[model samples]
Target: MTHFKSQVFLILNELPSGECIGYGELAKQAGFPGYARQVGHLMKNLPKDSKLPWHRVVNSQRKISFAENTDAYWQQRHKLESEGWIIVGNKLTLNEFDQKEER
Candidate 1:
């Protein structure tokens, strides 16, 4: 993998189960502070069967980045809720489960 991708993957791997961070935060932790869009792209391109916890990453608004009614959107919500996260609509309850950039 490329250096940036490797770094992003490392950040993703380090997220504790049931905790979630924003895409921009993930990019910052991966050493690309302004590359939130790139982080989204990387998550989008991850292998469907990959074991990475991609669902733990959300948008800056603490909402699911995916559009509503889509399969991916529901899937992410399901994965997160299954892990004890309380997501109402697309917005995650950040105050309760916010695991911000704590590097």
Candidate 2:
């Protein structure tokens, strides 16, 4: 995989349970400022069996990037809930559980 995508997944895997990093934030953390779209691309292309905590990544508004009521969004919410995250009003408050460890 490309270095940036690898870095993105590494950062994701480091997040503590119940925490999250938004797409924009992750892109910036991966050293590509203002590259939220790139982060989305990376997530879309990640292998299905990869161990990355892909569900912990969301949009800047703290909402699941996928459309509400869709299978993808429900799955995302389910995965986050499985990890102990709370979803309220389309927002997942994860600041308290953030783990900014480097890859």
Overall lDDT per candidate, in order of appearance: 0.88, 0.81
- For 1-103, candidate 1 gives per-residue lDDT tens digits of 8888999999899899878888899889888899999999999999989999999999988899888979999999999888877878899874344555332
Give per-model TM-scores.
Answer: 0.88, 0.80
Candidate 2 residues lying further than 4 Å off, grouped into runs, are: 93-103
- Compute the lDDT of residue 65 as modeled in candidate 1: 82
Candidate 2 Cα RMSD (Å): 5.3
What is the TM-score of candidate 2? 0.80
What is the Cα root-mean-square deviation between model 1 and the actual structure? Answer: 4.2
Among all windows of 10 consecutive residues in model 2, the one with the lowest summed lDDT is 94-103
Name the runs in model 1 displaced over 4 angstroms. 94-103
Q: How far is each candidate from the true structure, as Cα RMSD in Å? A: 4.2, 5.3
